[model samples]
Target: MFKLLLRRFFSLTLPLALICAAGFGLDWSALALADQAPPGAQIFELHCAGCHIHGGNIVRRNKTLKLKALQRNGMDNLTAISEIVLNGKGNMSAYQDRLTEAEIQSVAAYVLEQAEQGWK
Candidate 1:
């Protein structure tokens, strides 16, 4: 009867639709992650680049990542930078909720590396 046919159609199509949607969602997430630059580079571009272009602080002219500035401000290490990113010290905004912990770690490392290398 039509009732049986309707049940069969629903049973068959509903699971198929769910499976397809799940697959599509996973694929989209993977693609989105892949499209981003490396964790640190991507995070920097998204959050830090506007003000700290090339590791120079736009808001605080004396607070550049140029080795001396970092040492002077006690921000010459990943721990300090990560703390800043999380807590939002001075002119910077907090990214604790906006980014994952892994991302914070990555960008912190990146900042240290860039500073050590003179931002080249």
Candidate 2:
């Protein structure tokens, strides 16, 4: 009886311990939280606001995120903006590794929306 109980305990716990050691046993709450993607404005604030505050570029005056500049630079659409956010352009850093595809798209949409709104 003692040996059977000990064997059952090891059988149940060994795989769990192994899974945790392998980093598969993530916290359920953390996983749930990670499953939720942040909104576009939040993402933009966290990543792009420093350089492109209020849709204005601090580095290059001509390459601002405003409607006029975006239209002139051929970045007036979501695809163009998303591509730039993923691959980056001059004076802008790429966020392909730091953000997911959906996040990039969200921020791109946010930029276009804000541009249309005149950043108000």
lDDT per residue (tens digit) for residues 1-120 in model 2: 999999999999999897885697557777576556468988998899999999999988899999999999999999999999999988899999999999999999999999999998
Per-candidate Cα lDDT values, in order, are 0.88, 0.93
Candidate 1: segments with Cα more than 4 A from true spot: 1-36
Query: Candidate 1 on 1-120: residue-level lDDT in tens?
Result: 999999999999999998998986756667677676577977888899899999998899998877889999999988998999888887889999998888999999989988898888
Task: Candidate 2: give its CA RMSD in angstroms.
Answer: 10.3
Summing lDDT over every window of 10 consecutive residues in candidate 2, give the lowest-scoring window.
29-38
True-vs-predicted CA distance for residue 111, candidate 1, Å? 0.4
Clashes of 1: 0
lDDT at 17, model 2: 90
Report the Cα lDDT for candidate 2.
0.93
Any runs in candidate 2 off by more than 4 Å, and if so which? 1-38
The top-ranked prediction according to lDDT is: 2
